[model samples]
Target chain A: MNISDFQTRFGFEAMYDGYVDAEVLGGYTSDLLSDVMSKAGEASTLVTIQAHKNTVAVATLVGINSIIICNSRPVSAEMIESAKAEGIALFRTDKTQFEVSGLLYCALRDAKA
Target chain B: MDIPINTEGGSRVILELIYSLKVRDVMTRKLVTASADTGMREVQQLMRDNGITGIPIVERTRLLGIVSIGDLLKALDQGQMAEPAASHMSASVVTLEEEMPLTFAISYLNRYEFRRFPVLDKTGSLAGIITASDIIKTLLVEMNREVERLEATIAHPQTIDPAASPGLDPGSAGTPEEIVLSLSFPTRQYDFDGAGKASAEFKKALKQLGIEASIVRRAAIASYELELNQVIHSTGGVMEYILRGGRITIVARDQGPGIADVQAALTEGFSTANNWIRSLGFGAGLGLPNAKRSGDDFSIDSAPGRGTTVCVTLNYAAGP
Candidate 1:
């Protein structure tokens, strides 16, 4: 599934739309940046409540292509600017990280099938 | 030429060399001294014969003062060439200790206007003299030796057939060609704004080198964790990335205060960060472990009063 599909299918609002719309290989749900840095796979979507600039920095370093700030966690302007600069798709959802991760996993698995 | 002993941006090997080498190691031990009452004309003759710009005026190995070519010129202009060297020599000279680190000599050279400093031994007797040119010459020789040692350590690429490694991309299967890339980034303590920039750059460079994605990912993870560790805990530090001979080595060095306990610090979930830092999605105590797990070889050295140094080496080929 492409990064833009999250906004269209899950009704998540797009915070930054200047991304490459690359295919999302999978998803990692973590609020800890170290955990995300150590375990997050490349080209994955990050589902977390970390709505700050550092989160985008970690996403860029680890090759995470998309980020979904769950629970409507008030993403900062700097976060939006960083996401745009790094070409990472930024989305915000009213659902929790658990819900977003489940939905993303099923979607990615079904796409593989 | 100003020798920039840039601790924050210079190569670690050069920095270590300057810190490890003593002033006596590079100073010229051959003494060409004259008595305090020696005639200025004789001093001038000594300077000309030895091709030296300055000569230390001594009394039986006890340094009293130094007379430069400028002083001789002044004496000759004043028709006082026959005067004693003591009359024209500059006293109150700034001197360096023989046991002092080369870095001190470098700073002394920059701090003072003197072309050279007379090195004093433990008994306060003049032992040798050091100049900026001497430091530069020694550094060039040492750096050449270090480069040769590094080249000697370059391992031959493995001959694993691409077919044997399932799912290996043919484009990245062959041994990576010899390429040298060296980068340094200065990281400040609690500088959340600049954190991870080094690792991001490393990732980009590896991708451009056409390294396999998995290897690049591992290198990126190790670098990121190490960089973040410096930002969160150290006063300030530098991150160095060197890619050569199909291996990537990331070295992070910081200024004090260092870790108190190495074993405890490496344990999972052991963190010294306060509540505020923990709130920033860091300080979970996985930084070192994560770095170690991602790298093919890892070593960390830290002490309470001194700074910390972490080195992680990643190979291009996947480990067995």
Candidate 2:
């Protein structure tokens, strides 16, 4: 599904501008940068409470189609610059990482599984 | 590069070379010495023959004083050429440790008008001497190599980073087929603000290079895990990435207080992550296990006080 679909289904703010329509094949969630780096699969939508600039870089590096900054964390200006530079689809939500990850998992379960 | 004076960390290469350089690396180890009782005429002849300005006056292994050309001139003018070297030598001295870093020596040189620094060994005996000219000579050689490297980089613009090719075989690749990406990022413990920046930039660059999305994801995820692991478990560390032909390998090396057990740490849930870390959603012991699982091959070599090095290799050619 497109990030717009995910945004529409859950009230999430699209935070950065980059031409990204990457397909979401799966989803992974973690607040620890290490865990997410190791476990997050390809084309996955990464949902996490990490809203720092490094988050955008990780999302771009891991090929995460979209980044969901959970817990309403503030996305800094540096993060937005990296998001735009990396062509990553950026989003933010008031939900927890667990809740957002669950939603994305459920959304892709039938299609990916 | 001309680094802005206000910039933090300064120019990386300048700082790296300056700090990495040691006094032992540049100090003149072949020292010429004289006994305090040596005849003034003999010492003057030794200095004239060697073209040296001064000779350190010694008593066995202990440094007593220094006799310079001026001391010799004074002795000759006063008709004291028959006197011992100590009679005209300056007794006070400033010295530098043989093991001192070049930076400290540089600071000492700047703070004093001393023509040279007497280097002492661990036994407090004179080992060598360093002059300002020695440092300039060392810097000239270093700066020349840098210039050559920059020229080579300018000669070929397609390589990722010219400095990145330090370890590459001169004949490794003449074409783009074997073109690889080599980079390293330093990470600090408890530096949450900078935690994932390295992997993120790595991921973006890989994607731009046209690596398949799935492959980039796996490699990036693994990179992130290693970076975070350094921040959480070790002292300060660096995440090294080498993207070679179809394979991505990351080596996580750190300064330690290293791991006592590699096996126990790899267990699915046996984490040393403190309670505070747990609340932040890490230290679950899943970081290493997950990193290993993501790699086509993974191995960790670690020892106490020696630090840890975790190598993760992901072959993009292999199915994800």
Candidate 3:
């Protein structure tokens, strides 16, 4: 998906000055800890609502491009800076984890279709 | 008439020249360090507070093993009720000597999948520690610094647009025509593993120079897309940067199953990637378009079964 589509669908404004020119290669949405571990890489953008430092570390290890910190719980300042220094874009949504995952599923399904 | 093959642009010449680019030149010379005896609680807290996943366990310039947030997580799994750090920390250290070049550092770091490596002094003590993040910082600085100097020259008419009219600061404002900033990386056939290293390193060079945020993002996104293409499609390829006037140009060429339709391939949603590639989070067909959009000028040359080459030039106007 294009950056504009993401902005409209997710209702998010760029946190930094210049907007992120990201391409959705595909979408991976899951809360299952192990599931994420077995999949995901530095290239793939991850969608999750789990608000914990562990999530950041996991994303870093697998080299995820971006982490959609879902649930609108307000991303931690530390996580934000970590993502910045690492050049991994972090996106947060007011939508619950389940709702966001559903959206992601639909998005991916449409793309594949 | 015979077309003369010259060494002016030979691959061997390029590789030999780039091989000399050292790690300390690209590695974060001033890395964050910590004492080996740091407590587990403090270490974990530090990692969280600093937004860093790893820290170099050092002692007055002595290198010890490194600890990552993952290590701490494993420790937590074992037991998290106020345990001693000695129980959790791994002393099997991987290190790089301060004199060691950045090229060697990149190889070792990529092989070990290490986020940070402690730099040893002449005595094998921790002189400092470098992390993957440090590399990112350095690359970004290179791009940022270049843009700023360009912008500065624009702002001050007499300053001589650094790239076009230099002789002001060779180290910073040197003539762009003479400044050749290049980056190299290992490539494999459809090997998704460690593919982002080149782009990451390229971005680090930009970031380290303290380049403007806008230019950094431009070069980073463009470089990243090119790097991903190399890993996903090409047998291997290299990314090179050249500066002239106020334009910074990037060239990405790779040997692989070349595209049959360059224009169609440039579309937003035309992908020929497989399921495995898709699962890894790429192959959606946005790489080409994304690269095009990120830069002011873009071009692509390819053949059905030969290879593909992409070139992008970003023009920065002098800041008034």
Candidate 4:
């Protein structure tokens, strides 16, 4: 899945312009950045309430090409810069974290099944 | 002034005007002036002769008031042309400093609805008068210079940065000369928000260095795990990514409230992570085992209270 597909499925504002073409593998939800770093390794798209710069860092470190930030959290300018630098695609949504995580999990499961 | 610059070139010009252009550079030096005792009709005649809309009413060097076309029209309609120019002019005037940025003048003009503002020097003497037109014309000149510079650069491209080094040339493979890239990053405590940034940057640098894809992936995962461990488990640390022709090495040295049992920490499903960490989809006790999985060699050294250090190394063949 591409970032635009996620944008179409759930209304998400694409933060970094260049990385919008990043691929989505599956989804992992986390608020603590290290948690995602340890568990979300390669290909899994991350969903979280954390919209800070380090979230982008964790996603990039774990080899995740894209991330979805829930709860309408404001993406700071520094976060955008870091995401662009790390080449990690960033998405923001107004929906709560649990809702997005569940929906993404079901969607990924269905895709896998 | 809300000058709607639609073109890309125009936007560049506006940016230059904001940063480098000053009010004195754009203001009209040949200013039309009036005295307080001058008749409103005479002031209007002076404005008509000069084909200008505003004039500063001054006594010697001190600015007394400013008469605008709007004020003159009001006076003419009220049959007050015979009255003194100061009587018809606005005494509360907004002024700009000659040395101030043109952008500031534009914003000031925008803040209060005014046709023009008086430009003053450091000594509080009137230097000139500036309007929106004057500012735009100056911006156009600056834009032209920028366009010329860009054209020159495009015509003759130059390599500007000194530190950029390209990776291995693809033509040869059997060369024995070794190339190594070294990098270091400092990690902070509980900076859960910033946990793995260093690993991410290291991964990118590895990719740029044209390291083997499998090795880069392994190094990234290992470094990330170690970095997160530092943030969650250790107090703080320094992470170093060392890339040689045949291997990738990650050394993590951290200050800590050290672990009591190294074997338990490395075991699968044994964790010291709190509930908060678990709720965020981690603390599954997988970091250590996973870190070990990603590299061919992993070693850990720790005591209960002092500190801990972990080093992971993956040996790879660097072939063109």
> Which candidate has the top score in TM-score?
1
Model 4 stretches astray by more than 4 angstroms? A15-19, A23-25, A29-35, A38-44, A71-78, A94-113, B1-179, B191-194, B273-284
Descending-DockQ candidate ranking: 1, 4, 2, 3
User: Which structure is stronger by TM-score: 1 or 3?
Assistant: 1
Q: Write the per-residue lDDT of candidate 1 for residues B266-294, one digit (tens) a residue.
A: 89999987555677899999999999999
DockQ of each: 0.55, 0.30, 0.08, 0.33
Candidate lDDT values, in order: 0.85, 0.75, 0.62, 0.77
Candidate 3 vs. true structure, TM-score? 0.40
Instruction: Please state the error at residue B93 of candidate 1 in Å.
Output: 62
lDDT of 3 by residue, B290-313 (tens): 788879999999996788878888
lDDT tens string, model 4, B1-320? 56654321335445544545668889999988999999999998999999999989998878988999999999999999999997889999998878665665766666679968898887788999889888788878888888898899999998866322222324433557454777878775555545677887888888887877767887888888888888667656788776666778788877777889999999988988755445445577878888898899999999988778788999977756
Model 3 chain A is weakest, by summed lDDT over 10 consecutive residues, at A33-42
- The better-scoring model by TM-score among 1 and 2 is 1
Error of 3 at B218 (Å): 2.0
* Fnat per predicted structure, each in turn: 0.86, 0.68, 0.00, 0.59
For each model, chain A TM-score?
0.97, 0.88, 0.74, 0.88
Models ranked on lDDT: 1, 4, 2, 3
Interface RMS deviation of candidate 1: 0.9
Q: Estimate the lDDT of model 4.
A: 0.77
The parts of candidate 2 lying over 4 Å away from their true place are A6-9, A16-26, A29-35, A95-113, B1-181, B201-213, B243-248, B275-281, B315-320
